[model samples]
Target: MAARRASHAGSWYSDEAKHLGKQLDNWLSAADLCHGPARAIIAPHAGYQYCGACSGFAYRQISPVVVRRVFILGPSHHVRLSGCALSTFTKYRTPLYDLRIDAQVYRELEATGHFEWMNMSVDEDEHSIEMHLPFIARVMENFKDSFTIVPVLVGSLTPDKEGLYGRIFSRYLADPQNLFIISSDFCHWGHRFRYTYYDRSWGEIYQSIRNLDKMGMDIIETLNPSGFTDYLKKYGNTICGRHPIGVLLQTVHSLQKSGNNGHKVSLKFLKYAQSSQCCSLSDSSVSYAAAALTFE
Candidate 1:
């Protein structure tokens, strides 16, 4: 009966239920939903105040999916994980609701002996996966019943291991009842994040940084899985969730090869913004892009 409590609620987002509801409502209200039913989404996992509105662009696309479960794949910032870490907790607590863990799916995934199961407490310090819960809760709140979640903390993996994990997920993705939410921010620039290769004071240099983000986003929006990975390697994009997004791309590619009829997918770039654009701070900034992948 134990639950994984929200650790960043008050600071990262609103702690009070009503205030949190209003915050989410405002974001969703202003968001322009993309043209198709979202089978998957790529959203940023930074604090709600920092990237919440950007996240709404992706969430708005999947707002209409009548899903029973969501597979949240995010990078492990605090933990150096191998393969993927599945939470052992039974529920995930947020301001909106305590989401039930998809025990069956977790058990099934674990039974494959392909992934490691964490002691559940590991989630307490991991914000990448937890930060998306409230947005997901608010987006799916209108559904008849609460949906379950399978929180997967992705880590470093060898090519073979990555491909195997992708194959495992491809089957699940073939199902329409499930959704995948990839938590990631595009670029972390400035000396604060230790990625200071450019002088932000120079307008041209800053514009180039924005261009780099666009290049990455274009690769993702084109559904070129291999191209995305290659682009990251060529440019060393500091997208924190690259591994998670890599896995997602690998899984989708696997599904395509297997002739999964529903695997024909295309991504729509919904929005992009620099942290400086959203806040007063201009010295350092993290770029965020919201995109949705829809299946044919």
Candidate 2:
């Protein structure tokens, strides 16, 4: 099978190996390492200049975990589909290296009857999962054999479909070898994003956006899928990856119900930031955040 090429390389991040390597190394170096392993992580899927550093904070925590298989759940910005689409490509190409796709796991998942094996072209330009590869490749070099990924793109769907997919994927979480990476960016404030409500004043819009993100983060920290959905129902926080995150929480909650203790599953807030702090203009800003799900 033909591999999906890096479509967002130069624009979103470095296209050259040396430059990309150095850039990623810098981000990883700057982050403070977490004490333990992370079963899952929620990171930003924006341009490097905007959210790369914030993503680094979460990836740093993932670096310690020596898992052979990673399950990546990212929001689909371009496509709209029910359930989740798993990439059928043999590998995902990147400047750093072409990371292999976990074909065995992909086949197993396909056998389960939940995910549709998407055409390679469907994932060509999607940055959500592609953006995280270089970081994983850079930080996870300790693996003797290059780790493979199972990339799943989640889209808008009915609540029943959401819960169905959630329960489907939760079955795999029983294995400690399977790591889940949820790609998401927090809030898109200001007029450019058409999410404006508050004024453009730095202090006001900044604080308001941060407060909104914190509310969402509080729900995530609780690891309560229903609470997060309620927050979304009450006030639609513009979290781009809300669906994927919801699936993750639902998966965790499902495990909790089936004799898997909930106390062992918890979240750790890593970092949060505004796009204005990076380089975006003040009139419009997108918030970014990083967190890890630890199952002790």
Candidate 3:
């Protein structure tokens, strides 16, 4: 069965591939105001019930051109790796299907100074990356050619280092047939999030996250590396894959500067809703949101 594991089935998303695909399909079908086919995106990887709609927005904008590969740079939710972790798993089990990892690509990056193999904690039962499977599957169901994937879980990337990496990886990333995905979610507000008593709709939670997201989005729009880090630090943002976003921004800017930034590179606000907004009338609160990025 090509070494595989059902890390988040039945919990983070669903155990039935069809059902999961339907859920994502429903969200994408109704999305509007999205832009071109993007090579990369910053998506939230939380339980489907919460952020699925928001994440769907990003998936909805993807137009699989000649993409032969997908690189999901996820966050470290359950396990931690030295620099970044590259999974040796030949197949990553999801409800829709067990997608194969491009082993040779993994090795190629490993050969490069930018990549490294992870130890025991490289990948555990984490939904940060897995939650996105059905999404990609739904989008690429019609892809004519086989697709490859490289899952990179990044913890922290310094501002200066991110810039250097951007410069170094520009040419490496200029290839038009690859897609980059940054797995992340916005601010984790309140007690439910260990930030405070997120269980209750306290004073003003939306205000806080929106205030923070504004800063984060600005950095993305401006393609500013330092601005990204400064904003993240100032608010002590809880974006799980902050470092991954740093790498992505650097990588995106590198491509733009090199004159190969693609046809339609853009950031779109797909979905945004706090957990409190969705909690049952009788229940308390939670933080949740979804957004998508696309390139044409």
Candidate 4:
């Protein structure tokens, strides 16, 4: 079936099929691709060299011969999307392989009155979700049929709106067979990103930035919902996708409580490295992290 083509193939990742597949294999083999039965993954959306390893950890763990359907949620980076955007395409094209969207479930969620717009068109050029696909393809050979997706973009989600989208998404993916994913980069630091005050250069300043990100990390480590919001508002820590993370956590909490047995949510930090930490450029860079949270 003809569907959307790869938009970020050359820029964010490799455009060549062999290079893409080979690198995907190497990265997949390196991470915890076979970790315990998982329910959700929080992966980054930055460039391949920068954040690929971190993002690969979650996708590799969740995709290998298990699970069906992943509800990928990310914020609108290029354009501010209104409401949640569902994929109108039958299949999502990735450099590694194609993954289908669960049409039946998509239509079902569409009927729910909790959210508005249903801006399915926003998936076009939406690399937040697309970036995770190649990693998924590397793990699940029959990925197209093995797992489907309910791709949604979180753009302008107010508190009320996030709750609304959470409920609708909860209902749609409540089945025991599904997984959830929230695509996000933890914090953007440095003067270039404007997340930190020490602007000239963060060379070894990651120590200071680390202290700042600790505010966000504490919330993640302790699952402190309120403090997380407080820190985000106070520091203006351009996390870019806190809306999706909050809604996913909130939804998972509700779903487990209402289920026969509570769903388990555990977030593990796979890798945490800033561009400045790893590269010569320390003056202006973003903090990149890879983490996987399981919704049991």
Candidate 5:
């Protein structure tokens, strides 16, 4: 079977299995399982040095024994896509181990006729999906052979398209044995990113960014996709994975609407951090947040 190489392994993270495994174990060990046994998670996809520790808060919540499949939905950074695309490779190689792609789930999604197939080059070039592979491998190591993954590259989509894909994935989301991992980073602030919105009342520039991101996070926790859309429009926050996040919100909404109201699903953010503190207009910083979606 063909495999997609861990393209960013050496630079973004360690390529050696032993060293990388130890690093990930330290991060996971440091995190407390506040809201656990997550059905889904929203975690950052930056390099190990930047978001690795923050991502632990989200991954630590997983109950690996029960999971049979992992659905990774990440933004398409290199290619322009109007809808979602699935990986053609049978497996994704990581420093830790190779993760098998669920061909059965792929065929089922393909039968829906709404998804697209990503070529090997595009699949390998994208870092958003690949960054989560190591963490997924670490968190589910004991049950490694039992679970297969479905990686979906989400494109820039309209609100209607988000709802469409959300409805398509809702059936899989309903299954307790399936885990959804939404890859995203929060606000990208400063002139380099061409965004410099700061409220002086918030005291420091980073403080302002935190408050701004907090507002959006609060809205996301409510599971209101329209509200999130409005927040994006109002602030124009450079949330690269907004579309994927929107799709997850709509998935929960779709589930609740489809008579799954009795099964309560709640999303809560556990950690937040920035690459740097943007104290001035010239400084740039990328925010990272970790959240868990749990069913009560």
Candidate 6:
């Protein structure tokens, strides 16, 4: 079976297994597991130096032993896809280990008639989904062979389409054995990004950016997809993975509508950081946030 190589490794992150493992271990150890045994997580997908440590707060919540399948939903940065796509490869090669894709789940999703297949070139070129493989491999290392992955490359979906896909995946979200990882990075600020929303009332430019992101994060914690949509429409925050995050919100909303076994579900933001504080309009920086969704 063909495997997707860790093409971004050695540059985006370390290629050496020992060094990468140690880095993940240190970050995971530093993060406090406050809202864990996560049913799902929303974490950043930037390079390790930029968002890796911040992402640990999300991964640290996983009860790896209980999870048998991981569903990774990430945005498409390089490709212009109108709908969601699934991986064609059987395995994904990370520095630590190769993660097997769940063929059974792929078959089921394909049967839905709503998914598309991504060829090897498109799969290898996208970094949003690839960035999370090493972390998943490390967190589930002990039971690595016991679990399989489902990687979904979400496209520029309309809110209606997001709900459609959400309803399609709601069953898996209800399964305690499944875990969802939503890859996203919040707010790209600066002239280079062509977005410089500044409110002097927030004191500084970076503070304004923080306030803007916090507003969006708060909406996500409410588990209201429309609310998130409204926030995005209003501020136009440069959240690269807004489509994937919308799908996750819609999934939770669908589960709630179905009563979801009467279980209470809550999503909380655990960590937030910026690559650099944007002090001027000419400066550029990307925001990273880590959140966990728990079912109680």
TM-score of each: 0.93, 0.92, 0.85, 0.86, 0.99, 0.99
Model 5 Cα RMSD, Å? 0.8
Task: List pairs with backbone clashes in candidate 6.
Answer: none
**For candidate 5, lDDT tens digit of each residue in 1-296?**
89999999999999999999999999999999999789999999999899999999999999998899999999999999999999989999998889999999999999999999999999999999999999999999998999999999999999999999989999899999999999999999987888999999998999999999999999999999999999999999888889999999999999999986577789999999999998888899999999999999
Relative to the unseen true structure, what is the C-alpha lDDT of residue 215 in candidate 4, on a scale of 0 to 100?
A: 58
Predicted structure 3, TM vs. truth: 0.85
lDDT of 2 by residue, 1-296 (tens): 77889999999999999999898888878888783377889999999999889988888887445687888999888777777888868888888788888888888878878778666567886889988988888877667265778899998866667778778888777667778999999888765666754534536667767877888999899988788888988767789999989888888878888886555887887899998732234477789999988887
Scored by lDDT, model 3 comes in at: 0.68
In candidate 2, clashing pairs total: 0
Question: Listing every candidate in turn, what is its Cα RMSD in Å to the true structure after a full C-alpha superposition?
Answer: 2.6, 2.6, 3.8, 3.2, 0.8, 0.7
Worst 10 residues of 3 by lDDT: 196-205
lDDT of 5 at 286: 97
What TM-score does prediction 5 earn? 0.99
Show the colliding residue pairs in model 2.
Answer: none
- Sort the predicted structures by TM-score, highest score first: 6, 5, 1, 2, 4, 3
Q: How far in Å is the alpha carbon of 84 misplaced in model 1?
A: 0.2
Model 2 spans with C-alpha error above 4 angstroms: 63-65, 144-146, 199-203, 261-263, 277-282
lDDT of 3 by residue, 1-296 (tens): 44557677787777887788788888888876356466666678877888787777777667676677888878777655445667767877667766778887777767767766554344656667777777877787777238867777675666766665566556645676777777877776555555432223333545545656666776766667678788776767677777877887787787788887655566655556666542333333444444445555
Candidate 1 local lDDT, 1-296, one digit each (tens): 88999999999998899999999888888888764578788999888888888888888888445787899998988877878989878888998888888989998998898888776567798999999999888888877276788899899765556678889999888887788999999888766776654535535545767878888888877666678878987878689988878888888888888887544588777888877732223467888888888887
Model 1 stretches with alpha carbons more than 4 Å out: 63-65, 144-146, 198-203, 277-282
lDDT of 1 at 158: 58
* Number of backbone clashes in candidate 4: 3
Alpha-carbon lDDT of model 5: 0.95
The candidate with the higher lDDT, 1 or 4, is 1
